[model samples]
Target chain A: MNKIIFLLTAVIVAAIIFFVPPIKGLGELAKIIFFHVPTAWVAVVAFFSSAFFAAKFLRTKNFSFDELSARAAKLGFVFVLLSTVSGAIFSKLTWGAYWNWDPRQTTIFVLILIYGAYLTLRAAVTDEKVRAKVSAVYSLLSVLTVPFLVFVLPRMYFSLHPSPINSSGVEMDSEVVIVLIAAVIDATLIFVRLMRR
Target chain B: MKLFGSRCDCVLAIVRKDFLLNLRRRATFAAMMMFALTATASLSLSTGGALLDEKFLAAILWVVIFFAAGAGLAGTFDDEAQAGTLPTLKLYGDAQAILFGKMSVAFLSLVALSTFILPIFLILFDVGVEKIFLLLATVLLGLIGLAAAGTLTAALTTSAAVKGGLFPILLFPVTLPIFLPAIRLTEISFTPAQVDSSLLVVILAFDAILILASSILYDYL
Candidate 1:
């Protein structure tokens, strides 16, 4: 059942990505945005979910919550990596540099570092009880830190980077919005299907 | 209110005890200062005795302090774990006190290292401090942020099998809001022109939020 759902989602998403005309400003680079933007959203949502489970584990002292937290963070880290690499490729096409230290890029780099630290941290501990508690603490701290790094600090500076999705009021064509919405749903559903294990 | 007062006393007592303990051992203290000096010396030599700008000097200064703090702060909790005093401290049910105590000591050691590093940097790099007061304020706030974040993380990793190797990797990312703006504030301190107060505001805000978060989260560790 899951495989069939995944296959249908994949085929339709791929078709929309290829057939859709490029946006006015982005040209061919627009194709990457379909993947990049949705991947970043999944990563952010996954991290928040991880933190939620971490908080739940801390409160209940239940092993299952810890498992959920660890799994979600791992998946989130993978999505973050995908988003960053895709974003870099898109940046190279448009900004003439693969890494410009744009405000968004800086935030993404911090996100990568935070989760890279998280994975290494998980490996560094062996005691099951200590591992659960410490990683839970770290997961919460890292997630709390995301807002300052990704949103607050970036906006403090005058940035040439794309204005935040909602704030700049960049009008999207109806078709483009539909594809983005579909991509988000597709990415999230994939996350849920795998995380169930 | 009375409970809060006694907790503050406990925190101060821990701070005092830690200071005395560090004074007695002196190993951590000496290592931190020496490491900072050696790192600064290498930078001076690599620059080939040429003059450096305030920007370059600011970057090098924080690098020295960051590494020195990294070297020193791990010992804060690890020493307790080694002596088996950590469980006793836990028995007392005053984790906040312990955290504040560690934070105070971290801040002190970092400041001690900074005092030594600054004079060496000034002489070696030949960059004047355009506003000594501003430099002092900026470094102080940066140290508070570093000490808070470092103490919490070091405590979390205290029970890990590889605390030494894990400490820096875990602590560095969480402390970026400290170092990034700190480097900016330090750069502003070196410039003789009109200073950008915005960076200071940013650092202050980050430091405030970071310290508050660290305190709230310290109990979990």
Candidate 2:
């Protein structure tokens, strides 16, 4: 618990130093970096949890693995929602509009719906063993698209979001890279602590 | 010979049983169709003048399609539960066949509902033949994607205590990727550029993946 509280404190400090100060004339738009990027990172982490436990459940046929997958899915849903809402708010500040139906926005919205369905599926079925098996299979199958949505589709088409890799496949900005890596670590530690409990 | 015969018999038996049950419980189908018609009609009446604008009409049509699919797909599992047929069906034959049969029925019901609503849509909205055909294809493909994914998810969630609320929450996120391209395709059907094949491919890949997953995993359920 002490370690967890310390880690939480570290996250708060990171948010204040890196996110609170305005840089590059981004002003309020920069605040979204703390929320949007971390939420997305955590969402991916949640999905990976589902995938890992799904494989375990399938192989061992253990109810515990299934339960873990379900819990991860619920967390994933919250993260997806957070990413969406924060992204939208940022878009409004930067683009002067709340919703542009951009491909990135559209795809994230769809992902949220899919996760919603996954949770619904868990609830709809009554039998414990059966629900676990079915949902595990679903988590594995649905996750196949995660790569395409997160990486391929955004780059293939023109998007408002900055592409991490340029046309020649180079990093867009070193500072952006540094901030994103730190944010991912911070968010993942928080997610682990939450899920562990 | 005996094994094959029993398997065939089981498949036919389950199919027949589902069909007969659906026929007897025609009210669900009727309600779905009526809901689709009413939704389409109300939109047309309210936005009669706006129908002249193809872009607006296309957007509204897709909204209609989504809601219509929702109304039809929502009840795919209700009758099975009420009649106490799910457990028996699970025990009788290949779970894949049952899922396929149910999905087929849902897809057909969606197509039928769309057929009724389409004509009304054409009359109310001055859409062109090329655009209409493209939009129709989009709707068909979108419904297939919906039914395939929605049925499996719905089946999974229906077992929960508060399924009424949980159903959409679980389903909407899973189906969101499919909707983006679908809505985009419908919106751009009138544009000179050919329909986006990549988006269609994405939807098809998703459908195939979900169907395979549902079939292989449904036996566990």
Candidate 3:
């Protein structure tokens, strides 16, 4: 099943890159949205799952839940790093600077920082039970602040980010939206498969 | 009524005990003050008293306080951990009361640290306080946020194997959201501009949330 899903995702990605038309003004560089946005989305999903598992661990005192939570966090951290690098490359091409401290940029940076701290914290403790409890508490704290960071803080700043979706409307081209949605679904599937492993 | 009174007394006793311990050692307090002073002196010496933009001064002041607090506040629970009293407290003491007592100590020390640092910061940097009351309000909220978040982080670090080294790594990122609004508020406090009351609300919200979270989560820790 994993192999089949992986192959299917690869094919869909190839189709996205080759068949989908470039955005009118953004040109081929807009293809990045398919990869970047979905990765970020997956990272957010993974983090919340990690927190969910952590909450479960705290309540049940089960080591298996702790293991699942740690795995989810690790996956989330990797996806966040991928999204950041992809976003930076896209930023460099379009905005003339790799990192402009845009609201989106700052938000991602903080996310990465928090994720890194979570992993470091997990590694620092020697005892398994203690580590699980400590990291669970930290994960709960992270989830509490993350919504404010991602949703509210960015709205306060004037961003150069092409916010294709917002409360106002979805301004994205239909083809681009299709490809982006497909990528997001594929990425989420990949995340689920990895978590099972 | 009896339970409430005894719980309050327990908290007070822990706070008083920690206060006396703090008074006797005085190292962390002096270190926080000295660190803040040294940072101010270095900034003063570097710019040679040249006039600085208010925004820059505000950032500098927060940077100093943030780092000083980061350097010093992580040790709030260190002595207890070292003396192996943490387990005893865990076994015999109310987790909530111990947390509150430790948080109270941290808050008091942060207040004292800011009090000592602010005057020198103003004199050395030649900052004319355009809104003294606003400055005080912002600083007070910032310190509360710091103390609330810092005490929780200190508790966390106390349990880790690499105690001292891991404190800032865990504390800094968790506290960034608090500092971002705080630096902006501090910058505005230096200007005559109408304060963005929202920033104060944000810090207040974070302080309350952190304290509440710490209280709930302290049980597991």
Candidate whose lDDT is highest: 3
Window of ten residues with lowest summed lDDT in model 2 chain B: B163-172
- For model 1, residues B1-221, the per-residue Cα lDDT tens digits are 99998888888888888889888999988998888888888988898888777777888898888888888887688778888898698666488778887788888888888888888888888787888888899898888888888888888888888777788888877777778778877888888777768777867777777778778877766
Error of 1 at B64 (Å): 1.8
Docking class of 2: acceptable
Q: What is the interface RMSD of each candidate, in Å?
A: 1.5, 3.4, 1.4
The superposed Cα distance between candidate 1 and the true structure at residue B174, in angstroms, equals: 1.6
Task: Assess the local accuracy of residue B93 in candidate 1 as a C-alpha lDDT between 0 and 100.
Answer: 42
Candidate 3 on B1-221: residue-level lDDT in tens? 98878878878888899999889998888888898999989989999989898878988988899888877888888888889988787665688888888888888888888899999999888888888888888888888878888888888777787766677777777676678777777888888888888888888888888889889888887
For model 2, how does the per-residue alpha-carbon lDDT over B1-221 read when each residue is reduced to its tens digit?
Answer: 98767766775776577568778878777877787778877876776556355566666776777666666676677777778978777787767767877777777777887788877876766566466677777888888877877777667655566655665565555665566677677767855557777777777777777677677766655
CAPRI level of candidate 1: medium
Q: How good is the docking of model 3, by CAPRI class?
A: medium
Evaluate model 3: give its TM-score.
0.95
- The C-alpha local distance difference test score for the whole of candidate 3 amounts to 0.84
lDDT of 1 by residue, A74-171 (tens): 99899999999999998888888889788788877777887788888888889888888889888887765675676567765565666536765757
DockQ rank, highest first? 3, 1, 2
Can you tell me which runs of candidate 3 are displaced by over 4 Å?
none
Q: In DockQ terms, which candidate is top?
A: 3
